[model samples]
Target: MVGYSALMERAEEATYAGFERLKRDLIEPSLSRHEGRLIKTTGDGALAEFASPLAAVRCAVEIQDGLISGRHGFKMRIGINLGDVIVGTDGELFGDGINIAVRLEGLADQGGILISEKVLNEVEGKLDVGFEDRGEQQLKNIARPVRAYAVRSGADSPLTERIGVAPALPDKLSIAVLPFQNMSGDPEQEYFADGMVEEITTALSRFKWLFVIARNSSFTFKGKAIDIKDVGRRLGVRYVLEGSVRKASGKVRIAGQLIDAVTDAHVWADTFERDLSDIFLLQDEITTAVVGAILPKMLRAQIVTATRRRPENLTAYDLQLRAMYQYSLATRKGLAEAIRLANRALELDPRFGFVAALASLFHMVKVILGFATDPQFDRKEAIRFLRWASSVDDGDPQTLATTAMVSAFMVGDYESSIEMIDRAVALNPNSHWVWLDRGWVYHTAGVPEEAIRSFELAMRMSPLDPMLDRLCVGMGMALIELSRFDEAIAAGKKALRHNPSFSATYWCLASAFAHLGRGAEAREAAARLLELDPAFTISAWIARGGQSNAQLAIEGLRKAGLPE
Candidate 1:
């Protein structure tokens, strides 16, 4: 009832029917099975009081199984109130535990289940399911925030998603910074200590020639057992930052050690403890000590050991060197950091076309990822950067090509994205991303064949990556849009084979079935799509990130009976 928007997206008619059927068949029987009571059901969501939080969870798991096995397109999200819920004027309850349950439900996946920490502690060792601690979430309108965790949907837990699993570093310097221990006894204020290490790892990522292991990779060590030299060898980084935070009622204490992996030497070490309020300033000192101290030295050593004696014809590749560095960071954090550094670099030299071009590269992804709250504003920023780069340096092919791609793909001037990619390809035959971006543009334009060829070129240049997977998803959906069902299914299967966990592949599969008139398979594929992403409506998709390029897939799915 509370999550109608989510239910209706899966199925407008079946969602309702499934609700009634579940009430009559599974729910009423479950209450009898567990000696429980039926609290109430509004429309799409349900709220209930349980005799035991233990019974409440068992009922929830069974409810999910019934809906999925029954082929009901609608998925229900469950929340349970273990304590009192005082009736309100509007006929809703207002109490601490009940209020917490409502928020806990919102955190759950649309058709998946989420439970409060209170429920978790009560049901601990009694249930067979696993949990992923979501941490102490700051929510709206709660006096004491609850600690939340996500329950695995079934006996099996979902694999935590990480990008591009670090292949054998083969001399790659990938590393993670474990959360420094807050030996400070007061667990309530460890945010300051934890946040400092994350920023330093982020700064290390800026070294483009280096492969800084991702933040998520490093944070897995927030508070656990680890050997320093072993961690460095495992993470493939030559150095590690291990530290502890200690605080007393009157003072603070901090200590850290950076060890060289191969030599096992303490290359850099420092300790600083100050009043809690000065923690932010103290962090900068730690960062400067680690970054300004050790990373550059490691990079210099790696450079000495690298196969290539020096940059190949550095005189001719100056723009390539600088532009490539800018392109490495396409995420929001990376983009913002890139913009800051790019701006500072520009200030040092007003005619820094290369930096401006890099700014455009970073901003374009920023626009794609919904990084800025105002889409048009960031789009303007992207355009401004590209335009400035183009105006100043007509000879820089990197600037010209990036300018063109941003123009066509993001701004809806398809001609320009294609033109720039073409020009860039002419200038530097080895730029793999240029080809990939071109393929992305054509795929957006609903030109499947051209997109496929460009993607093929990109894949040829960088064969190890799963870029083919994206191409397959885009082209397969395009094929379905063109009413080529068999080909679409074939390509979709290929995509899944490469990355079975990818959700987009299911979207591609559903498109093929919808176009082929296999309503049963189409419905199943749609269910799979929902399983992958419950909030996957076209409108939300566009809002989350500009999917102006996937309009054809959206149209096909909408026509193929995707619920509004």
Candidate 2:
């Protein structure tokens, strides 16, 4: 977590509302844009977590830069560190990770970020910031020695011109592709090597999450035996790709290496041997392999750096993480456990809108799947929680999207639901949840084509998303409404592969298979659905705002031998 504290004591003494405006109006949006989760906030400062050290530092820089140039009247000091943490049953954080960061915050100069050595090592050359290495010092109550570094924002770095005056690193994982060495000795083969570099760069740029440096800037290092650390500093990239291409005796060989320029760590290295026939084909093959290899390595590194290993002392964030795991199980037991964990998280921080929304989702799922003991209570509580979430943080796209779905499905307020969901989409078109919820809204509105398009778009945004099964189930339902039974069957099967226990997946399969008159398969799916959700009933579902094209699913389930 990054701890940021305002420098002005008068700012804290001002009206509480005025201080909150600075956080709500200025600081928080920057955090959201960088995928940081705000854990808590006092009148003068806040604590937040990012997926990686790079994101934490970047967000810190953005906050400081905004304070200097924007209307915000005060500067802030930020401290960041990486370490193991414990998750409490109630939502709160504890461990050296939290303690060290807060102490370091007090040590930072106004408008600058101070990072522990652990953070510096993970993000040194990856960012354009200069580091003033502060030697190891003993922190209060900390048993071990800790080294800290002052992260010089681009404003303080001499290389700021090469890095541009952006003042912050790119939000996504950024990379630079140096010119591939022409090792074949034939001057004519230089074109092939250059073509490989160009092709690899172009292919990698297709992923929206990747920021690829332009070919012109990358090619500047082509012939020189340059230090990649310097290259990373110059380009403001986290990873650098360098390779060599060789051709002889009708055979082509390509070797590529991906480096974490900050720590100078070799992340991934590979070599490929292929036939020289059809030069373009060989180039395409090598390009695909190199890009494929680098992406996974990058993802693994980011995930590992972003999240610390869970410890025995659980914080609110850790509790939420645990709840999400239970929720993914989508079983009766899992739903109960998920609800318990979510409620505990809310108890710890009643103002935590994200957790309130998640708990509401658990209740809504119970109501929809006929698992709730008090269906009416669950329905009303879900809407109440969602409304509270909206009141707390209306700018949160996920909360808005979830609120929209609850409004439509539980409150039967379609007009307000559509309005809220549209607002969410406008706020964040890149959010997969926003698209998925929009798909559901469209499905309930009987717009099958629009629903399919929204689902497909969600899949495109997050091809390997953990919630892929849910997306597939939604798409299968939409396909069934379109009378595309074959496609629906395929989608349902794919959903099952991802999450066999997801009741919706079985229901979708049963409906699709029954529509296709595959009686045996339909019966099998129906049995599986009943096993997971014994209380499920087509008539009950229809009674609870499951009208419109959903009748298609109800009719199919009836044919598959489910009770009316």
Candidate 3:
């Protein structure tokens, strides 16, 4: 009951119904088979009494193991206690044992089980599941302190279930630099001013430790005034950088604000009016000033991120900037042309960090989505380009990240891929692609929170990027993993707005709708997905990027009519 609010706040009635079915089929049977009496079940934790403490622990372990076999984040905690009880007249039970059970349940990790010392002594070595001693725990309102131990359900290790990620904790400082609005009196000058912001954003992105929001996703809110907190909530960022450029008389007036999006407070604000010739220097000054101002104010823990990496050279970055213009236009021909330009740049300078990495990325896409007649060729090209680029400046952040991304999908070296992405991101703080690829890496690694951060950052990097449909779909999957179905649905709809033809959005919509018990909408979305990609199936879901994410995505679509 302690976390019932959070569960109900996140999960839908249908999700609880699924859990109820699970309880009826597996949990109730296993409990009865072991002679355990059902007390009551809350949203995420359950209570039951057993004639023997050993039976209680055994039933708890079995229930956990069974629930985890399925996907969809419908998980719970279990607590077992052995002590005297007082039964109430209204078919309810009460006692110190009941309180102890509730207390121990509160202490159990998600998808984990905990037992009092009394229950532990009886259950020792009786069950096949593993156990870890969390040591004695003291709780208020209970007469005496209690001793508790954690029980692992076999699939998840005791260490993984309990240990938290250091980088993504709430204490970590993060910022999103939104696309600077174009307020030049001349409409034709929009691109010029935006180009300036993009360059500034690109330059700023080279810092690995600072959490720079993706330009494409952040610029999605451009041209419209907005609430800062809403931006924070949607993007899950702590700080926001907003500015507008007004160009006139061969000069530009640029105003920027570093707002604490969470509190809607302006931490820093400055406006620079300069001649067009001073554009490059102005951009550099802005990047340095913002970075300098923010660094000292950052929390001490963030000062030492897990990794440090960066690319030493910027020569190839020029090619990337030009290619980005064509990519942003995003016509099939335009993207293809952009790839050609990037490839030529790679040919001229094989070790050009960003160009070679992106050239490999283009081929990697050709392999994944079947843009190339020979996927094997595309994959081989990706590996070759990455290998050559890695040899040139292995210390380059973009190089490591691009190599990692290709390796994760093509080579299946998940750990090395992530380690490389970490190194690359450390080197180039403003590399949106690195962050996006890193998110994909986490999704593949089955770490949902980190995945969400990566996608969110991706959105910030390319606010107008035509490719955001996939990023949004991926972000939705991450939310679903964390059991935020409503938010997941919201993200899916955002994806649909950008690219109506995106098959993944249809899948996300189908999953979110089904998980929420919106049967009609779910069916419609699933139908649309089948229409777009007839080969789409649970198998297809698994073959894509994330296994655990795909499993739940399959559950959602399968329930909506697409077969397993």
- Among these predictions, the greatest TM-score belongs to 2
Candidate 3 per-residue lDDT, tens place, 1-564, comes to 235566776776866776676665556555644445566765555667665786577567656655555343566777778899887754467978889888887788877778888887886775545678888788768867888888764353432222221213122356667777778767887876666666655554444223444454466687777999888766667777778888888777878877776578776666767777776676655554444444333322122221121323223333455565555443445557668878766765665555676667676655444345565677788788777767554655656777788777777778888888888777665555667788877877778899898887766655544467767887888787777889999999998888786666787889888989999999999898777666666764555433543556667877788867
Model 3 stretches astray by more than 4 angstroms:
1-338, 370-372, 457-467, 534-537, 544-549
lDDT (tens digit, per residue) of candidate 1 on 83-135:
66776654555677677787777777765667777778897775556777878
**Alpha-carbon RMSD, each predicted model:** 26.3, 13.4, 23.8
Estimated TM-score for each candidate = 0.37, 0.55, 0.44
Q: Which TM-score value belongs to model 1?
A: 0.37
* Candidate 2: stretches off by over 4 Å: 1-312, 544-549
Q: State the displacement of the C-alpha of residue 302, model 1, in Å, after optimal TM-score superposition.
A: 9.3
Candidate models: Cα lDDT each: 0.61, 0.76, 0.66
Stretch of 10 with least lDDT, candidate 2: 1-10
lDDT of 1 at 192: 61
